[model samples]
Target chain A: MTERLTLALDAMGGDHAPAMVVRGAEIARTRYPQVDFIFFGRESEISPLLDRMKKLKAVSRIVHTDEAVSSDDRPSVALRNRRSSSMRMALDSVKEGAAKATISAGNTGALMAMAKFVLKTLPGVDRPAIASFFPTLRGETVMLDLGANVQCDARNLVQFTVMGNAFARSVLGIKEPTYGLLNVGSEELKGHEILHEARQELSGLNLPGRFHGFVEGDDITKGTVDVVVTDGFTGNVALKTAEGTAKLYTEFLRGTFRSSLLASIGYLLARPAMRKLLKRVDPRRYNGAVFLGLNGITVKSHGGTDALGFAHAIGVAVDLARNGCLETMGRDFKAVDRSTPDEPAQAAAV
Target chain B: MTERLTLALDAMGGDHAPAMVVRGAEIARTRYPQVDFIFFGRESEISPLLDRMKKLKAVSRIVHTDEAVSSDDRPSVALRNRRSSSMRMALDSVKEGAAKATISAGNTGALMAMAKFVLKTLPGVDRPAIASFFPTLRGETVMLDLGANVQCDARNLVQFTVMGNAFARSVLGIKEPTYGLLNVGSEELKGHEILHEARQELSGLNLPGRFHGFVEGDDITKGTVDVVVTDGFTGNVALKTAEGTAKLYTEFLRGTFRSSLLASIGYLLARPAMRKLLKRVDPRRYNGAVFLGLNGITVKSHGGTDALGFAHAIGVAVDLARNGCLETMGRDFKAVDRSTPDEPAQAAAV
Candidate 1:
């Protein structure tokens, strides 16, 4: 049997919380029998859902908390006022060493703020960054700073690259993940001066991964690199734009299939093939975004995800814990130089 | 019969040069009989191609220029040298009032620089912006500042909105286009302070279009607004990312259809329907990107496009010139205040 581990979950977090959270845990428990859970939420709402899943109930415990972070609550307000909220309590469990990791599908900003405040940054890290993996042509590529810092300097970007390198290597199990700095163009002279500075620093790095220099937005889907690093603003926009384009493509295909009688019959014949296509690109399979560079593991599931999606998110947290992701990153951090690369006086010289 | 108009063509521009340029003009002439062309390039190369199309040759004139801007030339380098090159001479035709507009398929940076130098900005305009239209859920939407200015202040963005408004009204034929400032989120406090400042200034404007406030990257495909305005860096990245996503979708679909025998048969049966779908979203149909806010109209065709795509770009130039796009923008510029709005002392006040 595999070694047992405990994960603290924010039960009253998502859109269909408590029920979705409990059911998801039940599903996860089947795949990871040795894993236990500590659900943080209102006792009245969660206990009944746990009662329905006898197998999950056998391995789970509850930490009752009436307060919950709302989707509309500002990050600062939620952090300051909702100390006893389910999200906060779950994070606290990880901080206090009662749980190996924490998972939440609550307000993203609130979760990030609380996680940063509670768990704090790991050694030699300037700021924590959000990282997520998505399906790509070659396989999967991990991208960082999805919505964390709006504006980042060369030093911040270099730090993000380091964290992303660790995440891709440890959690994703790539022996030597390649890193790319996301920019408007792939040329050395293209984009802002900060990108150029970051490039200079990245080129001189002694990390295990190969620094791929600059990559354009399209390189993300092409799987040109194992890890993509960018500021939170551009990363968020690119992620959302890709999502929207996929939706548009689906809509177009649907309209085309329904436009004629022959097309309708063709759709029926291709239903199985279409199902395989849909499964390959299912958003549920890639539902978790982890806050990297934190003292402990914190995975944020999509807020509107169902049981299956939440279960996938739980799997992500389990994978990170089992793989000793924190330990891997910690060791890597110590080996690398932590000081910010001094800005070159003459940018044109680059 | 429509009033006759003349357009200058950079015959040596693009990957396929004089051959594609001449053929594209021939195709364009069929749709626009009232339009005439002045081809600028080596007479030896262009004259041979023009000789094949009698209809095009009847209404076309040639201006010999041995020098042509190479694809690898930097914008500043091309601007400083290459004065007598085909691309520069085409712009000069527009400046000298010999042609109503000019079109090119050369290096985008070179084209923008030459156009700005030769044509200059319209009265009260701070800088010229590159505007392009793409298919969306609801008809089409125009986006601007697509790599013309990488780093933009609030004042620059406000000017792009004004220029985009004029382009949609005149060229796209939208009576009152709705404008949206592209951002990471729709929330008032989501992005950089510059966005907030631009929003404040936009809200106070008495423009023709309705300001839809902030919009995310996904909104571009959703057709959430008629005009999406953003800084060149973000805009260029978002556009390329969307293109990459669309390509990825196509690849996945192709792989799915070939995975099984039944799927292959279904694809054959659905061929007609698929053709219809492809036509609706064909990149060729939306091949042109106009350099808005220039004193003279200039359209840039995709550098690697074929004759059909080049013709579509010519059509865009004709549409803009025939519709009096420059005159409309010039009139609007006169009515609007050109001064930058003072930056608010306290950002918290927004």
Candidate 2:
């Protein structure tokens, strides 16, 4: 366990926290013996699950964090006031060098605030961007700013492009990933002022082989572009909308199948294919978003997500921490890969 | 045959110019013979369709335009180049008072450009905004700037607010439509400067109703908020993403339904309900986007859409023209109702 990449799970984060969080960590420990883990939250709330996991040969330690951060509380205030909150303590482990990364299935704002405060921003990084692996109809696309800095400046967007590109290459096995700035139109005058300037910066970046031009929302599911960059606000909306619509549509099919006998039979026979399709679009498997620009690695899962989903996030944190992704991004930002298309479009504007 | 609303159709404007446009119009015409129409496009291309419609007891007229607008052309250039494009001629009718409102299934950019040129902007309005109606899970919600103006100033957002409130009232039948600015987060400081100012203005709009602070992207379907507002650039992306995802998800359902013999039987029994559900989410049915802020009525339909979809757009145009929506919005902007909760918030801003 000493040589393994250690993770601290925030047991009291997310809609189904402590219970699902403990279960997910337990599964990860048993599945990946090389991974070390610590569960942080109220002892009474976590002990039962810890006992069960220990019985299942999952982990060796669990720390009690009696305080909790409410989803509605202002992130900065919650982090500063709730000293023993699970989210804060998990983040503290990363700061104290006990854990290489932390996983939180709690309030995104609170997690981001705590991570930035405890772990601090990686050097030469303006902001820590959020990037996720999305299962698109056209294979998969690595997307950034899924809910980090929503109102992004030209510099913020540029940083997202750089970090996202590194993620696509290192984690997604993408080769010479194409970069796209999400805009309403593909024209030079298609987006807001920041987008306009981002285009100019990206053009001047002189990366090894960056893709040209803009992409729209449809492109995310279409795979016409590789690395999609957007402000966190729009990106969050796009992701959530996509998820909600997919769910509604799935319900429509279920109703159709249940309406009659023949349709029921057809649904049963086609069940495998339907399941495959569902698996393909499932966020759980693709459930990883590295909070880039953080000195220590951090990954945040959806608030209401289940165990399998949290495990997927852990997989991402493990890969990132193991590969020294933060260092790579730092190098990428510091002008190490000038010839690589993954570098910033312009020199850091700081 | 004379009872239904007579619509002016831009038959030569879309990607399937003249042909599919003619057939779609025929479908609409046949479905409602009382619905008369004016088809504008090349005489040669439209003549045969007119003859067929006449055989089907569907009355229709044709106006010949010598040119067409392509997808790639610039919006402004498309309008200037197509001096006699069918889309333009249809608008001419609306202007000359020949038609109540013009309906175009053409290059949306071209249709929007030509529409603004021929119809002109309303007083106190700098540009006409685009709006899309969604049969939301909660109710009908109007999402605007669904791709009209790319970049907007804080002032433009205010104008859009006034107009969207009007559109929601006119089309959705909501006495006081709730206004929400699209952003990453709901907090006042979550967006760009203009949006930040927009929040203050929105909070202070006093537009005869309530201003629901700010709403994020996923709120569009959650029924949490009513009227979603943004610049055309972002609005357009959001609209298309919703439409595209809707289509893809529905297709996934169809694939499930057709999977087996038993499912086929179930499909038969569910046919009625399935159609009802499809109708609930049909993008074509929710096709028209009113060009708000325009002095005269103009409606834009998806360029690749069918005639029935265009028919719906025609209906929207009729509704706006009849209701004098712009003037209604003007009044609301000038005065928020005393009983409305948002009145105080909008008082100083308006």
Q: What share of the reference contacts survives in each candidate?
A: 0.62, 0.34
Of all native A–B interface contacts, model 2 reproduces a fraction of 0.34
Model 1 lDDT, full chain set: 0.88
Shift of residue A103 alpha carbon in model 1, Å: 1.6
Q: Which candidate is the best by DockQ?
A: 1
* Residue range B199-269, candidate 2, lDDT tens digits: 88677656745888777766777656668888877776677677667766666667665766655565566
The positional error of residue B180 in candidate 2, measured at the CA in angstroms, is 2.5
DockQ of 1: 0.56
Model 1: how far residue B140 lies from native, Å: 1.3
Candidate 1 C-alpha lDDT tens digits along B1-350: 68899999999999999898899999999999999999999999999888889999999999999999998899899999999999999999999999999999988888988999999999878889889986788888999888788889998898899999988999889998999998887231389999999999899888896999999888999999999999988888888888888888888988988988888888888889988887776788889899998899999998889899999999999999888888988888777753334434333467
Error of 1 at A263 (Å): 1.2
Considering only the true interface residues, what is the Cα RMSD of candidate 2 after superposition? 3.9
- lDDT tens readout by residue for model 2, A270-340: 66666766775576887766788788888988777899888888888888877767776777777734553
